[model samples]
Target: MTLFSLVATHADLDLETVGILSSGAADVAGSVDVPAVTLATCNRLEIYAEASSDDPAALEASREELIDAVAETSGVDRDTIASTFRTLVEDDAVSHLFQVGAGLDSAVIGEREIAGQVRKSLADAQNAGTVSGHLTRLFETATRTAKDVGARTALGSRGRSIVSVSLDIAGDMRGDGAAFYRDACVVLIGTGAYAGTSLAQLQERGVRDIAVFSGSGRAEQFVAERGAAARALKMEELSEAFSAADVIIGCSGGNRQITAQEIRTLAGIGPEGREKDLTVIDLALSHDFTPEVADLPGVELITLESVKMAAPAETEDSLEQAREVVDAAVQEYLTERQQRSADDAIVALRRHTQSVLDAEMEKVRKQHGCTAAAEEVEFAVRRIVRKLLHTPTVRARELAAEGRTEDYVQALQDIFGLEVEPRERPEREQPAKRRRAEEFTPAELAQMAAHLQKVPDGGFCPHHRPGEFAVERLEVAQRLTQAQAS
Candidate 1:
């Protein structure tokens, strides 16, 4: 089977489309015949599937199947769904997932939440019985790479998220900065994971006057479970909750949109019938509040779009370090996957050798009549066969790692007339085609050296020893210098 990914994110589509797709496309994983994982986050709706065949026509059919599944479940137009998704195959697909798991593709860079979301997506696929061994390994590797990125980069120290970024925008708009979070009368909408996280963050920021309202009517139980840090709001008390709140946060993105008129009627009602300033921060993907609310007087609005625009940029050094981790991790995964392709050929060679050994031993037993000489001859022949097979076995793995499995298979066919079973070997870009040290300036090399120093010792494989990457680059530079002199 071949790997493929269909990605629709805020970078390519509007947040409304993403939200709608994520919420509505629940049965997408099961709709396909192959192993599939659907990662539906607020910012992206991604489908990772292992196609039953690697043929171009078969891959296209798989894409059509997924599009049909999503459209059927989400009530979205088939053409629209097709247009919104960007298909990635093999290496690109694997790299994209790693980037997402590492939080490098999130609205807020290095956000820790996407990593867990990635893991949960895999689990959901498993529960749905749509996951395969390859898909499981792919997701598990992505999760590990994400954790490695977090531990090795400055992103772990920052711990920023979409919620935090939204609050930062709210704080800036309120004019008192973060200090306003301490005294703000905040009302949170929704009782989901985001709502729980927002509550914890609010409490961490010293906000005590917090109330939570669940459109699904679970706020009472949710608040009770969380203790006294927050209070639950009944649907009838929304007017009063809005009137008393300084900051409103929407996390429960449900079918119903909180209309502009509803907020204008009850928001910030002073005792003297005056409207006070209010900041409405909508972090929901489906938008808990209407966009028209921003037009209301004395009200400010912060949305997922606004938060995305206001997301702070990470330091270049930290970002580069994180990217190096991702690159290394992707390379390691690709190497291991490629090495596995050699297994069938190795088995075929060993099987053929064993059959020949058994035939020769039978002849020896017939000629020597089961004498000690026959046993001695069998032992020597078996030892010789093993010794002869060692180089070919090692060569098979080396060739496969270099994306030359076909060459090794052809060699076996030519030399031994061995017919190995055809296996799926996804095509990958050769590493030599990547950027070389000869293409970089001295200053760039120096910067790379500095970044390499920040990378933790060792790598995903023993072949990648500490500082080995740096050594390779320097060797390339020296080779270039020698060629120029010659």
Candidate 2:
């Protein structure tokens, strides 16, 4: 099978385009004849597919199909995409995926959400009915390796995601994050995944009494799930809520932006509307708040562009640890794959030899014509067969495990005069039935649930406080805006 890949990461593509690419990939599965899986996160859009053949024309056609699908969905030029989008084939494709799972390729460098994203990609393929055993094995290996790296190494010892990073930045925004969250009346906008995440973050920070405004009018149900007694607001209460809110976090789905006019109207409402030192965080890809709203008096807006993970200072050591883990995992995978490939040949050779011995033993028994003589003759032949086959069998298995299967197969044919038919592994109809990953104890579920949400670190991160780059950038933007105002 010929594996193919294409990647667009945070360095090049925006999150919106990445979302488009993911949707395209989901739809593209219907069109491609080959088995394929797509993994799209805020940081990267990647696809892995195994074609039936490695013929150049076939590969080229497959490549073009992927490029065209992404182009149509994201409206990017094929050539432009080809320029920056990395392509990997066969083993290289496998290596890239492993690194991604290991978090070596993460934007935040060893972000924890990637493992879940990898799992999600596999699940999505399974639900789409586009992936089979090979992809499943690869994904399982990658995820297992990722968990190993996280647990064993310093690569992701703290375990952080984009949510944590964003929260860390927010924490550093107004002194300590924990302090800000504890005292602040947080107004959470949106009723989707991010909203849930934000609430979890607040809960983690000991923040309750959160005002929920559901963009989809499902606030009551969302609040009910948490057993929260806080009153859920309708769409109209958003402005009134914002007036008293110390922080308004927007993680709503879609393109419903909060206009500058809305803030102005709130300000015009007199005492309650005159909010001081308001912090607005728009975590949505399609920003929930307009930029002009940030220019409002007593307002501060932090979007994805401004907020980023506070990368650990001693990251060189962490990166080295991560690389080592990935390298070891890859080597292990390669060895296992080789051993599996060898199993069929080894089994075939043994079966072919056994059949010949059985025929010879039958002849010897017929010639002996006596029970005692036939038994002795049978024992002798078995010993001869064992002695004759021992060295070749042992060497063949060794060669197989070492990725020298062709030589092993050839040696069997040349030395043993046995031509073994290649064994075919049929596609498994279903994965071995097992508990869903989501099945866990209440405490375990809470921890896992927190992983999916916007979990803010408690100010102990390496990038905890603002550095020169972030501070300078903030100052420059403020200066430019001030000049424009004057």
Candidate 3:
């Protein structure tokens, strides 16, 4: 399966459109014949899906189809869709997801929250039963890539989420430039994760008077859950609060445009008014109002764009390190994922070989009429079969690890007369031994089959041979269920 990524971030879609797209993202993906995950944050919305093939025309058609779907679902125009969306395929898709999970794609690079967001996105898809094997491995790899970026790079160290960065911008825009939101009357828009995060950040910055406006009707519960001295206001109350607010932070995630006409009543307020120079921050992808609202002389506007530019982040060193780490992770994910191609062939070959060994052993038993010598012959033949098969299996895996798997796979098919059809998910089997792991992911099973080779016939006494046979735990038996795959 080919990976497909459709990303709409702060650079493209506004917070509101992103919210709209995300609101029905699952339903849209559920309409397609593939595994998919949609991750929506305060600053970005990304959809990762798997398609049937890697053909350019096919992928392009799928891309347009997805864009049209989002346009219809969110009620946005084609131009907004075209301008704000970026489509990535296969390798680029894998790399881009790693970058995002690592926080490099965020408006505020290296944001720590994105890693958890990535995990949650994958979990949500899994819960919905929408993830296939390839998508599952891709997301599992993404979380690891994020962890590596955080542990091995400076980008993670100096990273901050958009929430904290917006707060910083608010403080900077204040006339005194001394963390002004600490004592200001703050009006926070929206009642989602961003709203909750913004509220917490405002509280951290010492803001006592806070009011929230809910676009999706979740405000009362949100305020009550926090147990703070905060007021939850209806949408209509926004204008009155806008007139009296010292600072406004928008996390309102919905498609409704905050038209300047709605708030035009405050146009004539002078610089000497009670809340002169109203600081309005649009943290949402969709602006709180048309850009013209900032034109009002009495208001100073700040959006995520300004926050990103003014961010006091040390990014150069961290970014380069993160890129290198993601590149390595992409390679690792691809190589390990491709190892499965060799697995089916190896299993079939060994099973075919085992059938021959069993046939020959039965013949020997019949020839010698069940003597001890006949039993010894059966043991000797089994050891020989294992020894003969070991070299090709080990070499194929080594080549797979080097990303040179096709030749080995073709060689096996040619020599053993094997027919291999690639599978997305492995066949689940009940264990023959202990059931420690309830189930294994496709990626894990691939590695287990390739790397954890089983010893011959469970015979620990290799005194008849030149090699030592270590009896690993029964879990090894559970994993080496070649017949299950067959």
Off by over 4 Å in 2: 12-20, 23-25, 190-193, 226-232, 253-256, 262-273, 290-293, 309-314, 347-396, 406-486
Q: Per-residue lDDT for 228-275 in model 3, tens only? A: 679988877767776778877777746675655554564334534344
Model 3 residue 247 CA deviation (Å) reads: 1.3
Off by over 4 Å in 3: 7-24, 41-45, 53-68, 71-89, 227-229, 234-240, 264-275, 312-315, 338-341, 352-384, 413-486
lDDT string, candidate 2, 306-400, tens digits: 64434444378788888888888888887776676577667877788789988987887787775888888778888988897787677777997
Q: Which parts of model 1 are misplaced by more than 4 Å?
A: 224-228, 266-274, 351-385, 406-486
Q: Hey, what RMSD does candidate 2 come out at?
A: 20.1
Q: Tell me how far the alpha carbon of residue 162 in candidate 2 is from the true structure, in angstroms, after superposition.
A: 1.3
Of models 1 and 2, which has the larger lDDT?
Answer: 1
Name the top lDDT candidate: 1
lDDT of 1 by residue, 313-380 (tens): 99999899999999999999988877776888898999999999999889878877888888888889
Backbone clash count, each prediction separately: 0, 0, 6
Candidate 2 weakest lDDT stretch, 10 residues:
468-477
